[model samples]
Target: MKLSLFLVSTAGLWVAANANSVNNKQTKNDVCTHPFVDINGRCLFVNNFAQMDWDAARAFCAGFQGDLVTLDEANLLADIVDFIYKEGLTDRSYWIGGSAGAQTGAFVWPDGSLVRMGTPCWGVLDNIQRPGAEPNEKCIALNKDNFFFFDNFNCEGEISVICEYKFQRENRWAEGGCATMKSSAVFVFLAAALLGSDGATEAGSHVKTDVCTHPFVDINGRCLFVNNFAQMDWDAARDFCAGFQGDLVTLDEANLLADIVEFISKEGLTERSYWIGGSDRALEGEWTWTDGSSVRMGTPTWGANGQNQQPTGGSEENCVGLDNANFFFFNDFPCVTAMSLICELKL
Candidate 1:
């Protein structure tokens, strides 16, 4: 009878220990508060509580075991904007994890990855309202008033902040690292919904795997190299790209212009113009890409309102470039004028 009682007691103890372990796992899974949301497996906390300078804002996020939100993916950025809009914080600016740091205009995230430039990442600031040259603006903020486009602000300036932590639910945090969500269907649907037609291709869609070599960014399956090494005239720039099995980049879509601009801005070339592949050399008043395709004109294509702003230099300015003076707009310039250039390679 004593042996029977001892076995029963041991079994009961084992059951109690297992129950406690399960409860602990459950608690960890549901860790975040009401204000935080699970976005693509990351717990994002949007702090609109008070405005603080960039350094202070970073400290606030760190206090919560997170860092200022680092938007490394384009789709993730779209989701963040959607989340902010849903929460009715569209009027306020929020500090994110990006700064030009010691290298002005070379924005990098906390993890040492370079921030992606241009559209969907940067809000389109009105050309007329844009500050005429503020080199002091090194830190980046989400200008919610302008649809969450990243805007450069002084580091010392006070702003709200967004904090993000790697999702540690499922007891994966202690095992090795943060656990990635396992649903492929969900990832596909999210990418489609956030990016729509203009954003980058779907996650697993057939895109060129091997386009250009190292140091070139892949945009919409095309490899683009922004040449900071050589500044040459339009023809000479074209030759430089040719040497690398590519040509000066040709802006096919209006959205593409933004991506190129972002790349240039991130490269710290905000004040320098770069040659793209567009010229009326074939027929006056009619632009054609180097590959012999007709240029798309008008809204979403040309910067600064319409075609009137572009090809403005008349017959003399045949080659096209992204103008530095008005960074968002394109301007016609003499083909012989020396400038930085962007090269593109298709897979």
Candidate 2:
């Protein structure tokens, strides 16, 4: 009797432990609040099963933290279907990530244009082409009712959707080290707004001295100062700025202008003819900034239309200057005179 009682106690304990383990797993899977299944390193979600239209299904995916499936990798898609199966998702038709929405002869994911193409397979047999396959349908749909058969459906037709967000490894900086990523560099600039361009000058002086004054901080970029009083052709000024990892200074916003002015004031550049942003390479009659942005600043320093007037003969003037007056517009100048420029780079 004692032996039987001991055996029964052991069995009861094992059952209790097994039940607890199962409950823990269930809780873990249920933790995701978004309509998604976390698998491998991505979050996957499927939209409701309804025949609405492609656009509607896309919007639904956007709402649920993903987009219509653009399966670049075959294994990933298989994993997704397995998840759907476990969840008892019986959506007969589902939209996926293949579309020729932008142009013919090419397929692109609606999510982003940067995704690279990978092995294409569909359904149980992993066949890209099948009998009666309408390759020109432009959009693909998975028919779950027919055991996940792939179909080329009209883009206008509505169906369910699946979304996936790949996991990104956040780069954490070591202690005492600054953020090193490009995005982090932008954030650092925003946080401090430290003055200065990424300009530099090599030491040619024979005298050993700490006599030079720094008008701005390096912030991992360089800065160059041009005396406004000095007359320089547009080309020379551009070359000068280019030598320092910058282009001819173009002021698109008031705050940017203010920053330049602050730097100039610190550098004691009070009365020089600095180069302004103007280029006419693309369209001889039209003016554009160095970055190809539109030159929309009103009331240029060289006077309105003063820099843009078409002269009687020489090659269309392609450069401009900022006079002591109307500071925004460019005054036409030749391209080869040496002038000051500001260089910039993300720290």
Estimated TM-score for each candidate = 0.44, 0.34
- How many Å off is the CA of 121 in candidate 1? 1.3
lDDT of 2 by residue, 268-317 (tens): 66556567657666776466877676664222122332123222224555
Candidate 1 per-residue lDDT, tens place, 1-347, comes to 00011112321221011111111222344544434445544566776657899999889777767788776554455455655655566667999888885855577777655665543345445554322147888888876555565778898999888887644322332110011112221111112111112323222222233333444555444566677768899999988877766688877654456555555665576767889999998888898988787775432234442113355678898988877765555668899999988886532
Candidate 2, backbone clash total? 22
What lDDT score is found at residue 208 in candidate 1?
36
What value does the lDDT take at residue 251 in candidate 2?
A: 48
Q: The CA-based lDDT of model 1 is what?
A: 0.60
Model 1 residue runs over 4 Å out of place are 1-35, 103-105, 128-132, 166-347
Off-target runs (Cα >4 Å) in candidate 2 are 1-32, 111-120, 123-136, 165-347
Q: By summed lDDT, which 10 consecutive residues of candidate 1 come out lowest?
A: 14-23
Model 1 TM-score, 2 decimals: 0.44
Top-TM-score candidate index = 1
lDDT of every predicted structure (CA atoms):
0.60, 0.43
Q: How good is model 2 by TM-score?
A: 0.34
- Models, CA RMSD each: 17.2, 23.0
